[model samples]
Target chain A: MNYLHLLDYAGVAVFAATGALAASRLRLDIVGFIFFAAITGVGGGTLRDLLLGKLPVFWIKQPLFIGICVIIAVLVFFTAHLVESRYRLLLWLDAIGMAAYCVMGAMIGLEYGISPYAAIVTGISTATFGGIFRDVISGEKSVLLSDEIYISAALLGATSFVFLFSMGVPQIVAVFVGVLLAFGLRAAALLFGWTTPRYKPRQGRKIK
Target chain B: MNYLHLLDYAGVAVFAATGALAASRLRLDIVGFIFFAAITGVGGGTLRDLLLGKLPVFWIKQPLFIGICVIIAVLVFFTAHLVESRYRLLLWLDAIGMAAYCVMGAMIGLEYGISPYAAIVTGISTATFGGIFRDVISGEKSVLLSDEIYISAALLGATSFVFLFSMGVPQIVAVFVGVLLAFGLRAAALLFGWTTPRYKPRQGRKIK
Candidate 1:
């Protein structure tokens, strides 16, 4: 609850940067870059608020959040070529945003008195849906469709927070642990090239 | 306005049917079909409601819309092979839904006292976004990305409604006129293979 905006703001900026980077890869116009940035920065929270019945959403009530995104996204557009391996930078920034947003989403859900399971789902959605939107629009493969341990990391963080908080852990302690676990898992996957096992298709449809 | 649900229900059901047909193209499981159906049926309105600050969304308050989608999607799943040309059928159904949804969305937007321009955009978004979701997830080319007059049709419908209503026309007459124009434009495109002009690239970038 305390200082929530710090992490949320940082995460949104990072996500918006990823969107600009995505536009750079496609050599899109400046408007494309800004559109991508704004969507990536606020898309997740918008969906979460819709499902959670938070009227007006965060950005509408507080235009400052979107202002932050647009500024950062525009900045990224001008500085995009300075960075090599834009994909790698995107991935890393996305991981950081994922960890921060996941914790924040779960915290908000818990504050709303929703069931832990739904809260966990809300966290995962808030963390990953923006990336999904970015990937979809950019024509890049989505992290969700990848073999990488993307969502599972967010899942771990959300579950850890819900579990720890229910077990009498202090709110700040639970939040830190959740963010740490999520970032740790995601970073480890990136560092070690870890992947989840793919689903095996069944042989035939004989029962039908 | 007297029976708003009639058009909305028909449009949603048609959109859901198209989703089921999309899943059938991939021969996915029943779960996949249902998921696609639910998303395609409600995705546009969900985005609109979020932006319009309609808390809990229509489906959350009135579960019957979702129930209709689920039932229709399941039915299509079992009988998909019976259709002669699933893709063509999907396109036609989507066109019909697009026209109905475009007018309904514009009407709702006008009712909310939003500006005519925003209301027109809202109508186009409500009509086409569900199809966009369906196409993106199914790996089919989105109508938005195509040269076809997809969004333009919805645009015409929405603009027509806003203009007619503003001119003191009867709401019922305006609604019918909007739907007819949208459907007519879309149908002509599908029948005659009409396409919007492709974007031409500008020459060279300015020196930094």
Candidate 2:
């Protein structure tokens, strides 16, 4: 298999692990883990395809994508407790998945003739929306709701790809540049607790 | 507009109102309120159409469907507190929207040549998934997670339509039968606290 295909599958596996880990924390049933894993792994791309009018979505024809998620989820369900620091694992794994997905999503958008700006937006949605759906559906505070650098990292990656490609960079080079930059920023955020600057608070604002 | 069109619009408006009300409870910003409204209004049909491979989705082509949701959400943002019993209003409005969406989803599914059983599944997904996403994203317990009769109501409506249509009932008559039964059941559940039967206690089960 090509490197891109390998990256794609690895991304799916890592994200699925995160999802299954979340399900384990919630003490959900096996079915819940698989459901969460499947959605988290595929949700972002599904949204991208649907919005872009790509018929049948990416996973419908080759359900091996979904099968990978299901298997990972089941594995995590059984072995999650063995992980020393699930939260840290979740962050590191999510960083890997997010970068790969961001580039992949942008690639698809560009292929579909979407404009650069909208393609970046598509990339961001692809990388982050799945985790948002996963956390939200699980009654966890959504990642987007946090005043963190997570989504900003995705934005950076997508923008970098668009800019590089527009500047005549080879598609492969642009993709790697984007993915590495995004993953690096996210990793830094996790390691150093970097966060977005919060808005100056107005009095009487009840931030729930 | 035809009767079906009226139902469709009204259903969207009501669902949007529910979404806005949920956002109000969460004290979300106006943008958040409107975003919630649009998703809650169109989320189900979006899922249905995407799965059925109906390209561009129902809203991408019309745009008016999204416009209606935005208008309702904004109106509700300023007026939600005026309602004395927002929860009661939410339940009633949800009942109306759910019934209409269920029938509409089924109609589209059957039109696409999906089997009746899968069509019913489609209807349930279309009617309930939007609300599921709304509540989950808003950090509220999802309706589907509750041991309630909500999905059952949608199931009944879709099934009734499929049965009536297959039995040579007029299409319009079948539609009405489905919508009415769904609404009736949901309304009854709200009024009477009619819940799904729970399994007999397996003690020490942490059904969180």
Candidate 3:
């Protein structure tokens, strides 16, 4: 299998782990865990494919992806109590998944002949949307509302890939650099408490 | 335009209105209103098209639908205070939109050669997913978790449509009957405090 395909599987697995962790936090039933895992694992790619008009979606065509999500969910469900710092583990796994998906999504967008700007948007969407879907369905506060520069990391990765590819870099090299940039940035943010500035209400504004 | 086309426009408008109402309740800014409206308006149809592998998504091809969502959002933002009961108005509008979209979605599924069961699922998803997306993004409790029998209503509509069509009923008649069934069920549920039973934990089960 190609590197991209390998990254895709790893991304799906880690994303599914994060989803299972979220479900455990919510104390949802096993069905909920599976549902969350499947959705989080495939939601972003599904949206991207739909937007690009790609037929059958990636997961629908290959049921193995969903089977993997289910297996991960079952594993998480059975062993969640044994894990230390589940939330921390989830964040790290999600960061890695985001980096991989960002590069993959941008590459797919380029293959589909989308403009660079739209492709970058697609990449960011692919990286963050599954988490958004997971958080929303589980009724948790979305990471989008957090001060962490999550989307920005995805943006950096996608832009790096597109720019490098435009400059005639080989696909494998471009993908490696892109993934490294995103993962490095996200890991740094997680480790060092990096955050973006929040919009503050001006005096006498009566912010709602 | 045909009745299906007319219902599609109405569904989009009413769903957008419900989204705007949700944003207003959250005291979100104008941008939030527009964002919610656009997502809720197109969210269901987008999912349906994606599942059926339909290309270019309906709203992407016709920007007018998104434009209408924005216009409605702007109007609602300016005029929300005049509304006597926003939630009640929202529920009613959502009922109508759900009814229309349920039949439309099932018809589209049949047109795409999907099996009856899967088409019914598509119909339910089309009717309810946009609202779920809206409520989730707005951080409101979803109607899906409510006891209002919402999905059941959509299932009734879709099944009615598919069964009638399979029986050689005309498209217009099937659609009309289907819409009426869904709307009537939802309206009755709203008026009479109808509710489905929730799962109760068994003694000694220690349900998580």
Candidate 4:
């Protein structure tokens, strides 16, 4: 299989697993678990296709994606009790999925002749929108808006990939650099508890 | 004001009110209530615009939509007890909003020169997606899936409006017809307690 296809499968699997894990946390039924996984696994790509005016959508034409998601969801559902420390597993898997999606989205945008700036944004969006969607459906606030290196790391990775590709770097090399940048940044943030600064409003005072 | 603009305003108000009611049912905070209302009021249009590659999104460009939604949300939050028995009020409002979105979406789709079938589908999508989104976020099975007459009514209304416009009907007449169609269908369903057939799994009893 081509590198892109490999990355796509890996990304979809990781995303589906993470999504199922989240749904399991909610103690939802099997169908609900599969629904969450399927939505998260394909949501970003579906949105990208719709935006690009691609017809029929990606997952619709390829039933394999749905099948994979359902399989992962079912496996997770039955084995959830054996999985110790679900939070840690979900975090690491999500980070890996994030990197994969960012790189793939940037590659697709470039293939479609989108501007570099827009391509980078789309890449970051692809990496984060699925998690945001999962959170929203589960009635939780989106982690993307919180103090994290998530979107910023994806942005950096996408920029690096796009830049290297534009400079005639080999596709595999560009993807490696992008994924490493994202993974390293995310790991640093998690290990060090890096946070965005919060602004505090003055007590009993209005600041315009 | 142009008839189209007036209908759009009415639609926004109706959807915003329904969102507010749903938020109230969940006893969300003021911020949460307005957030839900704003999203439910404009989510469909935002999705449609994003799919059409419209920049900045619809509600982002027109902050008035958000402003109106917030006001309605605040009103609902403060007056929840009074409207608790006014569930029909919410339904009628939602119908109006769906109708307005259908017409506006159809108009934009036609302007963009999309195929007639796609335009009509887009219109229906633009009308119903907000409600689907609201239900998903609120952690309820979407009414769209179980409510038979709902989305279909919106589709019929939009198609009829487009057909009338193509036949040189006046814009005001088209709007009236669309709104009536959607509202009339919904009211009929409500009065008759109509619903889609529930999906049933095979019990698989061994034949003796």
The C-alpha TM-scores of every prediction are: 0.60, 0.63, 0.62, 0.58
Residue clash pairs of candidate 3: none
DockQ of 1: 0.12
- Once fitted onto the true fold, the runs of candidate 1 whose alpha carbons sit more than 4 angstroms away are A196-208, B1-43, B50-128, B143-208
| Candidate 4 C-alpha lDDT tens digits along A95-167 | 8888999988888888888898888887888888878777776666676766766787888789999999889
Model 3, range A103-204, lDDT digits (tens) per residue?
Answer: 899889999999988889999889999999888887888866677778889999999999998899999999999999999998888999788787886777
Candidate that beats the other on TM-score, 2 or 4, i.e. the better one? 2
For residues B92-184, write the lDDT of model 4, one tens digit per residue: 777778878887887777776665555665677688778878888787756554433576577678888888878899877976897688767
Q: Global lDDT of each model? A: 0.82, 0.82, 0.85, 0.76
DockQ of each: 0.12, 0.13, 0.15, 0.06
Instruction: Report per-prediction Cα RMSD to one decimal.
Output: 7.5, 7.1, 7.0, 9.2
lDDT of 2: 0.82
- How high is the lDDT of residue A136 in model 3? 84
Which lDDT value does model 1 have at B202?
Answer: 33
C-alpha-based local distance difference test score of model 1: 0.82
Task: Report the lDDT tens digits of candidate 1 across residue range B1-208.
Answer: 3456788998899999999998998798988898899899988887778777876788999999889889988999999889899988998999998999999887887787666766776687689789888988888866554445676688788889889988999988899899999999989989997765432233223323
The parts of candidate 2 lying over 4 Å away from their true place are A1-43, A51-128, A134-139, A146-208, B145-148, B202-208
**DockQ ranking from best candidate downward:** 3, 2, 1, 4
Give, for candidate 4 chain B, the lowest lDDT window spanning 10 residues. Answer: B199-208
